[model samples]
Target: MDEHISEAIGRPDLIRLDDGLLCLRFETMKVVSALAAVSHLLDTGVVRRGDTLVDSSSGIYAYALALACHRYGMRCHIVGSTTVDHTLRTQLDILGAHLEQMPPSSSLKLDQNRRVDRVREILRENPDYHWMRQYHDDVHYLGYEAVAERIHARTGGGSLTLVGGVGSGASTGALTHYLGKRSVDVRLVGVQPYGSVTFGSGHVADPEIIIAGIGSSIPFGNVRHDLYDVLHWLAFDAALAGSVDLLRRHAVFAGLSTGAAYLAARWERREEPGRTVLFVAADTGHRYVDTVFARHQEAARVQDLAPRPVRGTHELTLPWSRMSWDGSPAPEGALLRSAAAGAGPGDGRRASKCQRSRAAGEGATSM
Candidate 1:
């Protein structure tokens, strides 16, 4: 392995969270595995030359897909959001991938259909464009499956508590299935921002948030709801704080959504014990320096007051009347606590509860 890759894998101290949950840090491995899987597909004649690959991606996945397409000598067209990170846009350009941005909109809400529309438009314009729909793509799941298998192998196929946010839901869904197939006792925990409608119903039913590419506005086809044993809803402020906390403590700079996943992992650690808790730092935080780290910019937005909803306590009703993907009733009480109690926490059991109160009334904030 290259030195950078080796260094990433060699960090033993880096794996354990403060709460003693084993942090899997699957982002790096997921990207590397995605590349390897694509390479394998090319070598095995699954993906041929001159194929124009199309995908609706946020930033990180776009970068990965762009690199994969370049290595495989395939033309790539990325349908991305206007709210995407500028650095990601530059990276995609450097990789020679055709980039198309969504239409302008003043609202913080991102139209999920925009990218899908672009894909349809491009495919209509060119007959050879093969849409690599990550939301429902088997290849996407295959790549994530490799990461889950590696986690299982590393832990001797032992039970673990997994937590992460969904962009396309491929990572959570695939890993859940992969681990279960190995008969490893695992609890898949899905995290989403307050404004996001991807995982659960919330006060703000926005399809997507400005965090750009971590969670979807629409429920992805591959999200196997049954696979997720627990769901944790994180607020943008808490996510931002978690990102800052990780930077201060571990020197790990990660994106806002990554921070959300981290916070969810922390929540998992507090409630459960004896089982390793794995969280995905979805992407690096360098891209979020201006947005999350800038005090001046932070001052512009109104104060966020969304109460981090816990699983128990009838004080807070389910954010939505019904679940988005399935009409199943939302869980009552503290969601994270319920999951942790059922799954069991890491070796060190520290019970930390959410001290913040809910926002005065129902109002949505732009993520």
Candidate 2:
């Protein structure tokens, strides 16, 4: 364990969890690991203590940075989006970190780049702020690498396919680097939401994706696209269903992104049976209780759509996209037509209808 993390989480209770699913119990330790990485960067002169650690985070990274700053006595600034959870914002404020909210833009979505731009603007206004630039920071992965090392050790360094969601792409890249150097046999698998364009896909402006902690609008310098042996993009519904399934079946309540990672792992395992497929459950799913777990509300939203069995490499459509793109008013013809016909009950057949409806609109940018 990193010295900074050891101090934060303490030694005896760091890795101990109730059921070994490693959900809520490990959060403090994860935050500690993040702090340790930041401290290491500061100690090595890669980043200075006075430098402002800036990141475009939904919540977790901001929370981590806030705690890390508290430990290192560094000022932390976050470029936050409007879509972030209100509870997370409150916690950040309590941590004494400054938040720069990015105004929504047409061409440039409320993404990491927008946050980066906001950070740049703040720095321009105050020359004293040094952007920590987590996207480009190679040291950010060192702590995550420790996790990979632990996984390898636990798994006996076997040939495994690691599946994980990409936020800054730091964790995936760092794990790939560490595992790759340790052995040439391990495969790295990256998962992203359908609308994310983090990899080489075009930019998406204000995509309505529910899965957090993955899919950035801007690309990270350290992300090794070529290193990934396989890539999978999951739909919001599939990930949502996966999360539900995990809770119902495995009794694991993981976040949507972690659910997406688990789905990808299962999908890969189905294709290549008997293969050791390891996936990281990034966070717990308690944060999404109002969204993903709200049975009645979510059902009402997708009442017009039905579930369908998706085959190989199928596109998943979101309910919001059925309305219109640019969040503009729907076409008069369709609006009038739907009103006249009246939306009917959503059966399994509505899946194809939803797919066709979204297909007519602009396709999502890949990440």
- The lDDT for every candidate, in the order shown, is 0.55, 0.53
| Number of the top-ranking candidate, with TM-score as the measure | 1
In candidate 1, stretches whose alpha carbon ends up further than 4 angstroms from where it belongs are 1-14, 26-46, 108-110, 202-210, 295-367
TM-score of decoy 2:
0.70
TM-score of each: 0.74, 0.70
> Model 2, range 299-334, lDDT digits (tens) per residue?
222223233322222223432111101112211221
**CA lDDT for candidate 2:** 0.53
RMSD per candidate (Å) reads 10.2, 13.3
Model 1 lDDT at residue 57? 62
* Candidate 1 per-residue C-alpha lDDT over 285-305 given as tens digits, one digit per residue, 9 for 90 to 100: 666786676632342221232
Question: Residue pairs in steric clash, candidate 2?
Answer: 198-367, 199-367
